[model samples]
Target chain A: MNKIFETPLYPYRRAPEQDEERIMRHKVVVVGAGPIGLAAAIDLARNDIPVLVIDDNDKVSFGSRAICFAKRPLEILDRLGAGDAMVEKGVEWELGRVFFGEREVYRFNLLPEAGHKRPAFINLQQYYFEEFLVRRLRELEAEGRPVEIRGRNKLAAIGAHEDHVTLEIDTPEGPYNLETEWLIAADGAGSPTRRMMGLDFVGKVFEDNFLIADVIMQADFPTERWFWFDPPFNRGQSALLHKQPDNVWRIDFQLGWDIDREHELKPENIDRRLRAMLGEDIRYELEWSSIYTFQCRRMETFRKGRVIFAGDSAHQVSPFGARGANSGLQDTDNLVWKLRLVIEGNAPESLLDSYDFERILAADENILNSTRSTDFITPKSEISRILRDAVLDLSAEHEFARPLVNSGRLSVPAVYDGSPLNTADALDGPAISRPGAPCPDAPLGEGFLLERLGDRFILLTIDADAPDEIEEDGITVTRLALSVRDDTTGALKRRYLGDEPSAVYLIRPDQHVAARRPSWNENLFRAAIRRATGKE
Target chain B: MTDLILTPNLDNADDFYATLLAAHEGLTKKESDALHARLILILANHIGDNKLLEQAIEAARKAG
Candidate 1:
């Protein structure tokens, strides 16, 4: 096993603020150095906004937790300069096969045929994911960007205020006080910041435990997601197996509610289960193991005054759909840009309300999907179990029953269909590329469309008349003029231009569509920019 | 918008009930419940339309 988590990647050191009597206020303080916190800090720092990320632990996450990273989050990470390394190190797989007993129920393809840049999903250990993010943060620091990570620095207490928040941080040296214009609570599901703030997650709690066993082994198994329901190895209990990088495989065995938690984690018990599945002749070494129960919950709102919650701190879903870290990255992607604008006074403070409006929608989507998956995997009632088993059995024989089998739908980026920032549809575009939806990627001659969009508010005109740039109020909407010829595969036409001969799209910094029209009209585009920036 | 077939599509209800009882013969309670679930799922899928299925479910409930 890789010793990536044994040593502290970011060790704690005494800072000048600890000695100085003057309390220094930072631009942003992200409480937790996990994926969400690091992404938020890196994005802010790259935008020239000073950000500090503090975590209780100094090492990478110990186990191979959260192995699946979806396409959209990968794209967001790519924008943060962390995607290439992760894609290179991560195992790319898309096929998920469901099994009932010894017979295969059905198989599903998670990705489309072509035209997209990223894969359906990549399986990398959470430690490696965090390590790559930390590496990206280091590069930003090397570039003299104002980003700092203080490990072993725990938030002892939080004082929320009308304008800003006061943070009492406990380091190995001692306790120090700092103020921040904005507080981003990226702590994990068991968030201390949330507890201090008296915020609670309100949702369903599943009454089942899953023993996650990550093992390093040499096997000729194809790289595919294998989920078994009522398998011979673990009859009546569901089991899930995923192939990760470095010959490591993640296997989860469902342990029913009310089991001896410590006894179930015994290596002998884990080995027996593994032997039953992989056979006694199988050679493997246990890497890591943990038991977790499913809880699909989220806070009422992500923002509370100057304290804005992100990732697990705000909402948490069962890990079945790989929505945990993936959604966390999107949270930072959606948050950092808006925060940067507000910090620079480019947008009103009220624009932050849109963050709550948008992320709450995404969180609800994640929670709903996760709860459904959990209910399917672990049937709550006898009738439900009978129906579920019927679906599984019928799925193996009939094509009609396949759709009813839910081994957890693959994670997809949430389209903010009802975002307040979105303008009413003016130009007829592909439904997938509608306003408030993430822009579908299409090859543009040599590079991808999202790479061109980057992190900017752009007026993307396709065979439409538009100026080089338009300055509405204080925000400048740069134009990226394109022709149908640039779409070699015609995916742009199918995705962006539906049946309309020409189209103009106002793309947000996060590459979500803000507004669109058939052709660029300055008056309408100006109003669009105003509405998009929450200026109206 | 096809409604549920509540007016008896089969000519003899006695034969249909006897056949259903015969299918449940020698089966345990759990097995009978499983068979019933499978039959219902099959019929529901064949019915296809959710509105029509909702009507059928409501009619079956009212018959109780």
Candidate 2:
């Protein structure tokens, strides 16, 4: 932690601006300053767009809420110039061990194949993460693009028209009215913003309740993903242990539906559960614990008129795979570029609709996959439980059951099939065929992998015969000058060209392949550019 | 051409095509052609579905 960041970064003490007066009018007003909202706000502000970020909290919350973050979000934070910061302040889990009853069934390294530029997953408490983001936002504020952080304020009402949105905000100062070109509701599930818009968040709410506790322990343990499928602690309880940055440990206990809600959550009851779970012989002190119920749902529409939804406002998924926060941050990354184009007038208001479509697809994917993962761990039915246990038991001996017991598919990235931006043919291989899938890390220069794609359009030409051409619309075209037969780049070669064909691939701003062709025709190339940039 | 057209969410393809056709009601071949090109790009931008976008563009071009 930096010395200056320990205190309030941006201290704006105004002498009560008038109620009817416009204190500030920004291009974008992001509601809530959590990870997702803060990501969107800082992204816009960093790019020289003034953003007013309002949150009702007096200061950053200091509890561990959303803890686990995946590789994609780490890449997103890397783009925001916080990759190194996260690495400095977080713990990375490279290995995982799964236990089925008292037996350890499987042990595997997450980054076994080894080609990605970033690690698989990092665990950083949401409290510390927000503090880091707020610090960075304050630094950007000093450089002219100020992110106005207004805490102790809640959104009262928001109405949008063709050109801009009118917001009636209730602040500690008083009821204030402001206007903005765009309004983003990054508020959490049970969002007041979504409710006000009359949008139905359709999904199922799971019946089981999970109790989480952060404890300080003096036990000898290794830094690995440790889980007990069916622990001896409680009859129907499952437990998870995570090694955080400090010596502290985060443990979660699955409490079945029949427990007394009021009596079970007390400190004494929690201590008893901990002693029963970890054994009384182990010395420990409880720091904090809370019981929570999780649900899985996606909003009907991510965008209603000019007001858009991000994070929990748009979707809610089971926290089994840590998809909830990661997906929200991804929504911000997908949205910021489209919002930038609209704000700069490079694209029409129609471009904003892509944010909704892309995010909704991602959210649906997350909800479905996370729900399945939860079911696998804590089966709702007796038969399902028996089947899951049988699979886990067989995983130790049978080859087929090993892969079945892995249940690691939730971590894989979702591929978008219906995206118009993808121009690859159906015959293209898995590496390059899918629409809106993140391009795999390819070797660039001597030691550099081509995974450091920022906010720009990239054109990769693997075929030596392809012409050297770059568009005036800020597209960067790089030539590989390698033969199409090269196995190292065979996927790119095959997708862009057939046998003995030229290798050319156009990558979008978000790193998905925009277009690929064996040999480039100038007219077709120009049309692809126009379509990609949403120009007719 | 109608000023506004109500379409299904772009998640589904059949709804998107229906909406495009509904928006182009009572237009000339040339008007429809230009409109189709513009609509393909617009809808492509909406769905982020590159395959659907490619399909829409090829269909519009073939129809013309």
lDDT of 1 at A415: 90
Please give the DockQ score of every candidate, comma-separated. Answer: 0.78, 0.01
lDDT tens digits, residue span A1-536, model 1: 67997879999988778999999998899999988998999899899899999999999999987889999999998899988898999998778899888888788776665888888778999999999989989999999999999999999999999988999999988899999999999998899999998889876555468899999887677888899998998888889988988889999998887789999899999999999887898889899999987577889889999999999888888887899888988998898888888888889888888899998899888888888988898888888999999998888788888888887877899998978889888887789989999998899888898889999899999999899988876788899988998789999999999899999999999999999889888888888888888887
Interface RMSD of each: 0.6, 23.9
**Cα deviation of A51 in candidate 2 (Å)?**
1.4
Best of the candidates, lDDT: 1
In candidate 2 chain A, what residue range of length 10 has the lowest lDDT sum?
A1-10
Question: lDDT, candidate 1, residue A12?
Answer: 94
Local accuracy by lDDT, each model: 0.89, 0.69
Name the candidate that leads on DockQ: 1
- Chain A TM-score, cand. 1: 0.98
